[model samples]
Each structure stands twice: as structure tokens, then as C-alpha cells.
Target chain A: MSRLAALVRGLDPRLKLGTALFLGPALWLMGLVQAGVCAVALLCIVAALASGQPLGGRMVRGLLVFVVFWVAVKAGLDAVSGMEWAQVAAGAGDLAVRLAALLLLGLSLALSASARALGLAVAWAVRPVAGGERAWKLALSLALMVHFLPMCLATVAEIRQALARRCPRCGFFLRMTVIPQAVIRALGQKTWNQTLAVAGRGLDGPQAWEPDFSWSGRDTRCALVAGGFLVWISLSLPFLS
Target chain B: MITVTDLDYVYPGGQGALDRVSLSIRPGTLVGLVGANGSGKSTLMALMAGLYTPTSGSITVDGCVNPGEGRAVRAVCRLVMQDADLQMLGATAEEDLLLGRARTDATVARARELARRFSLLPAWERPVQTLSWGMKRKVCLAAALLDDPRVLLLDEPFSGLDYPGMREMRGLLRESRAVGLTQVVSSHDLECFIDLVDQLVVLDTGRLALDGPPDAVLNHVRSHGVRPPCSWSAGQGVRSWDEESL
Candidate 1:
């Protein structure tokens, strides 16, 4: 892979999350206008491929589920609003594709980056404006969130497996009882102790090792390309509208 | 060497955990800290590990007061708590072992070696939460030993291990002792580590009840809510605890 491609793999998760946060509304607006649907899809495909993670069966299933749910909800609303079937189908298709593109952006970012790096990146981003203590605390909290995501997923899977064996026909109420208890037990002590351990290891406050995140020449080129694309999109916006 | 002088520790809620507990641990010796549940073994180990400041006394590791010289104390001593799940901070077993170590070829090699020794080679890259309770404990042990700390304190090391796992841990302790690593193993099970420990310290309700060589003080273990080891009982040809009465 090229340097930019490799850099994207290790890019700060904060940047990726920020990009998604910014792009999400843009994609939503584009969907509303029924414009740039193809462009957004192309960007999603490129981002996914560049992330170097295969669209696994589970991810595909999840995407399909999301798309189906979106279309169903749209159809329901349209039916209640007395819209024709053809118009409803078209609008729902547009919304589904747009939502898929947004989800792809989030998945690409989540799969490619590390949480600690994201926390550090958040710290780095807010360093100029935020006080040192506030930045560090925010960084730690963000890092904890990153760490908790996978742990929560694993806990759910574990509880599901156990429940499947013990009470295969159990209802949602049983899961409500068991899962939270198990997850809490699994997650509660670790966070507190690990945070203390981080402090105990003499790494409690602000991180000592500064991350080298200075934009390289390649990054400048990429930025230029992105700027050109943004200009092109802005210029096309008037025509599309 | 580790020294505790009139060590008194009280929790924030004003509950005493260790009361006037004082002892000197010789360099490179394996000590067994046996006590009943809530008998302050964990608290004592945590204090010696520099995790807590002594409320009214001093604990010095190699002449450095623990609370005052925490960094210095941590540089030489490592504490592996009873709950391995809480102690393991790494996402994966390998990461936990290499947590604070410099990411060099030598450090990685040492981490791999320790993982192998602890029977965690199969799950070296596996997330710690996916591992079994015994495997998690082993990973924590490997992480503690990865830095080659001079003083290793284990709280209930054999709590969740099987017979073979316990034997493996005992062997590791012996090897660590052979390599001049001082170890304090705190456990409720006397039979598991009784023979291996050169010194045995008994705690009863947050106070030191007995401290001496294993044979000398093993007789008094029963009085402290801890059953005396089989060897200690059998040595006197007594099957019942009351008959061996010390």
C-alpha cells in the first residue's frame, strides 16, 4: 500500500470520527436533496477498501439489517402519509444507500484505529484551547469509551451464548435480567483498577510521550486533493439544487 | 529486603486493615502470608506494594519508604492481586505482559518467554477477557514477572487454579526464588504453598498472630482460623486438628 493508505490505517481515530461526524450530516442532506448519491457511494467504497478490512459476513448482515430497517420505517411513514408506492420505494432506496454510506464511514474508522491513539489525538486537538487537566481527563474518558466498546460487545456475546445453552427459549425479560448483571460484573472492577494501575505505573496524568502527528508532505497532498473535491462538490451544489 | 515498622493501615471508612503489623523480609526469600478471609493479607500486600499509604506507620522496600518513594518501590516490587481480571490492564495477554516495558526486540522476547512459562503461549495474542479464570490469573502472573521485579507479591495466587496449575505456579515461584526474586504469596490454602515458603506469616483479624519458619509456627495456624497444613499435622502423627493442638 502507499504511504497515505498506510497512514490512514494508523490515523488518529479522533480524526476519523470527526470526519464521520462532519460527513454524516452532509450525506443526510445530499440524500434529502436526492443529489450526490453516486459520489457518496463511491467515497464509502474507497474508504472501506482503503481501511484494509474485509466486509465480513457479520458486517454485511448488519448493514443489510440497517438498510432493511430504514426502508421499512420509511415505507410505514409514507403509507401513513398517503404517498404512492413508487415514490416511497425511490425515497426509501435513497435513504437506505445514504445511511449505508454513513455506516461504512463509521465502520471503517472503528476498524482501522486504536482507542488510545484516539484519546491522544483528542488531547492533541484540544490542547491549544483546553487546559492540560481538562484535556487529559477528556482523553482518558474517550480512551475508556473506546476500550469499553469491544468489551461490551464481547460481554453481550458471552451472555448470549450462556443463555442459549441454559434457556434457549428465554424472552427479552430474562436477557434484561442476566446481561446487565454479567456485563456489570465483568466491566465494573476492571475500569477502576486499570485506571489506578495506569496511575500506579507512573502514567496517571498527562502522557509524557508526545505523538508525532505533524502533517507530512503526503498529508498535504492528500489535503489538497480533498480540498479540490470539496470545491468540485460546492460548485456542483448550485447545479444540483 | 522489605521492612515494615509498626505498620498501621485504616481504610477511608475508618476500618482498620493492618494494625501494628511489623516484619522484616530477607532478600531473595519466599514468604507465605496465610490468613483467613478479611484477615488483612491483601491490605498488607497492597501497602507493601505501594498501592496505599500506611495510615500510622512505615513500610520500606529496600530502605525506601513505600508511600513516600512509591515510584522507587514500584520499580522493584510488583503486586498481582487476587482478582486477575482487575489486575490485567492490557487488551491482550501479550500486551499485558509487555505493558510498561520498552517495545524492543529483547523485551518482546522476554514477554514471549514469560508467556510460554506461564502456559499462555496458546493465547498470547488473545484478549484477556476471552481467557479462562486460570488463564487470566496466569497472564497476570506473567505480566508481573515480565518486568523482573525483585519483590513479587501475590494475593491468593492459587485461588482459582487446578491441581496442575497450582503445581506449575509453585514451580514458577521456586524458579523465581532461585533467580533471587523475593516473593510474598498470600493465600488461604496452606497446603498449596506451605512447603515452598521459607517463612510463614499468619494474620488474624488485621493483626499479626504468628511469624517464623514454617515448621516453628505452622502449629499455631489453627488458632488463627487457618487450618494447619497436612504435613504439619501428620508430622505429629495426628489426624485430627484438636489432637495436634499447639
Candidate 2:
């Protein structure tokens, strides 16, 4: 809710999205030397939560899934390398930290930023890459992704509830599969309804209302802090070798 | 108010629900288009809302054939679909209406006004997944009416209204009619709209079958040995319709 509250109250929206883009990937790569990166990610998480921007509950669930996958991947890598138990444990711990750093940081960015801010930031980024309608199209797609990501998660929850309620007489293959299938069906239905309401509504080009965001002093400081961290990370990575 | 001329529509399976159906509706008139399950009543409504493009022919509103042309079809006209579930877009009824309204064009004060007019809606906004059937229908109806559209299309609208709700709906429709608003309400349930609708349009296997006044259609059906739109067997005074129709 803090994430939502901050977004509603308005911040340097462009800074929010710009922060997300670079921070997201940096966290993921930091898995190479996990501990420090995780600490950084945790800072991001704390900042995001403090913002009072409401994040989807499903996002937390997804991060948990990622954690499971990351751990499994790290364990598998250690096993394949045939490392000693001590080294393997250390490696696993490091990888886990790295994965957490990436996921938590990504989540913080997604939670703290509003769609308008995200769109504006992307537009700024894309302006040089692509011109005219193409840039806006990319921006619109990104905007849709940001707004609809939460909605899709909410939808999957409703489907799950419906699927849970389906009490088949026997645990036949069809019965077991039906529950998952019902979820797909529900999603399709929701999509169809969107198509319905959007029929005459133009899907072409950018909408009349583009997001308004300005890079403020707060933004400059945040960017500089990130730059400083990058410098430190680069300097430390050589020492690790 | 509304006119359909030689409207032809073919579904995915090549099912022709509406085939060259033509009907004219006057302003301040409540027109009822009744038909069986696959008789193309819903298809016609879809065409009217510009949700689906007709294969051929034309559907005009206040003289405009295409809804995509301008504000006539969009601003003056709106459709309330058969499935009330399709209508509830936002977490709450008020939010639902706002989402459909172009965000840039809408203001919080205007939204509040529309919500207040359909005051029953605020109660429907809960977990949204937990609203009762009638309340859901009401929420959907409220969404369609937001921004005060000039012509209303209620496809099987009176599906789950209680006695009081139905009465309230009738009052709204009458008020709309009195103000010279055009409305096309499609339903097989003729009992409730006996007085509400001025024109009757019946669809039979994708063709316009009956189009006239309620009394005239009744007389025509009786004389031709066809069943009346409503099953009135003898002199039973018009049953006051309070139950909702889907």
C-alpha cells in the first residue's frame, strides 16, 4: 500500500522507471557474487514498501516460485561441478542471494512505479531508438504490460478458486486436467470480454493522454547512488577473482 | 430513433443468425426484439453496438450507418450485453463505469454524479466476485447508463431484478422515454414490457418476423394462428411484471 500511496501522491515518475530498468538487471548479474548484491536489493525492497504503492499479492507468490527455481538451478549447477561440500554450500548460498537480489529488486521496481510513470520513462528511452508511432506503440505495449500484469494475476486467482470448487467424483485424468483447463477457459473468456468493450474503441497509435513525468533532484540523487554502487561493484568484482 | 436495413450477419460456423432484417424505431419509443435462442436477436444487438460488423447491408442511428464514423454511435448509443458478467469491468460499479468512460474525458465530479444517480451501485462494490445475481445485473446496467447516453441498448437486460428493482427500472425507462430517448430492449419476456415498449420486433431464424405495435402484433399472431408474443390465454388482465427476465 505504501508503494501505491507514493505513486498516487506523485514522485519523479521517470526516475522510478529508470531506476527499475538498470537496477533489475544489475541485481540479477550480482548473483555472481551474491551477498553484497542481496543487501542492495533489500534496500530497494524497503524503499518500495515505504512508498505506500499497493502491489498485487500474486506478485509475492510469483517471487516465491522464482526463489524455488533459483535454488534448484544453483543446486544443480553445484552438483554438476562436483564441488566439495563446503564449496557447494557456499556456492548455493551465493546463488540464492543473487536470485533473491534480482527478484526482490525487480518486484520493488514494479510495485513502486505507476503505469503512467513507466510509460513516460519508456517513451523517453524509445524516442531515440524508434521514431513516431513505433515508439508510442512500444510505450503503449509497456503500459499495458504494467497495468494488466496485476489484473492478470487477479484473474488467475479467481480461476483457481473456481477450479478448486470443482469436486469431481473420481480422480480421473480428465477430472484432474479439467481444473487447469477451466483456468485457461476463464482467461479466454475474460480476454473475449475485453475485446467486446474495446470493439469500436481504437487500439491504434498512442492514446490522447500520455503520462506526465519529470526527472527531479530526487531522481538525480537516486541515479547517482546507483552509479556509485555500480562503480563499487565493478571494483570489487576484480578483487573477487 | 433506430433503424436496421437488410442487416446480414454470419457467425463463425457460417450460421446466419440475422438475414436481411429490417425494422424502424421512432424516438421516445421502447422497441422489443424477441426471438428464440438462435434467432439472431443477440446478433442484431451486437451489430447495433458496433461490437460486430455486419457482412452486408446497414444499421443507421439518427441517420449514421457506421458507428465508427463519429460521436453519434459511441456517445449517443451504448449497449448492455446479455451476460451481466461481461459488463462489470472495474472492482466496483463506479470504477467499472469510469473504466469504460475514456479516462482523459472523465472527471471525478462527473463520475460521482453518475454514481449518485444510480445510487444502488455503491453497495455492489465488494470483493466484486461476491455480488448477488440481481446486484450484478444492476451493476452492469449502471455501467451502460453512465455518461447518460442518448440511445440505450439493453440486451436481455431485465434478467435478475427483484420486485422493487424492476419497478425502479420501469421508472427509469419511462423517464428515458419521456425525454425522447431511444431504447431497444431485447428479451423474450414480454410481460414486463407490455406497457414499456411501443414497438415490437420479432426475429425468427435470423429474419425480422414481426415488427409493429404490441397490440397489432398480437392481433396479427392470433389471426394467423401463430402464437402471441406473450402467452395470454383469454381475458387475464395484464400481469404486472416484477420478476426479472434474462
Query: Which prediction has the highest DockQ against the true structure?
Result: 1
A3-67: candidate 1 lDDT, tens digit per residue: 54456654444556565565666666553443355345444554554444333346656866987
Evaluate model 1: give its TM-score: 0.73
Please compute DockQ, using alpha carbons, for every candidate against the native two-chain complex: 0.21, 0.17
Cα lDDT of model 2 by residue, B1-246, tens digit: 677778888877787778888888887788887766677877788788767777888778776675354345655677777666544534445445554235444454566665566565466334344566666666666666654666788877676777666776676677677778788888766766666778888777788778888766755534332355343545553344545331
lDDT of 2 by residue, A1-241 (tens): 4553454224565665665565566554543654465556665554555443234455566676887787878778887888787887777777667666766666666555545346656877777778656766665556556555556777667765665576535465755577567767776776676556544333323542243445577667767876787666655444443
Model 2 C-alpha RMSD to native: 5.9
Q: State residue A239's C-alpha deviation in candidate 1, in Å.
A: 12
As for candidate 2, its interface RMSD to one decimal place is 5.3
> Model 2's DockQ?
0.17
Residue-wise C-alpha lDDT for candidate 1, range B1-246, written one tens digit per residue: 999989899988899898999999999999999889999998898788787889988989977886688768876788887767555655567756765455678888888887777778999866566698888888877877776778999888898888777777777887898898999999998877776788999999999999998878877889899998776677752232222211
Docking verdict class for candidate 2: incorrect
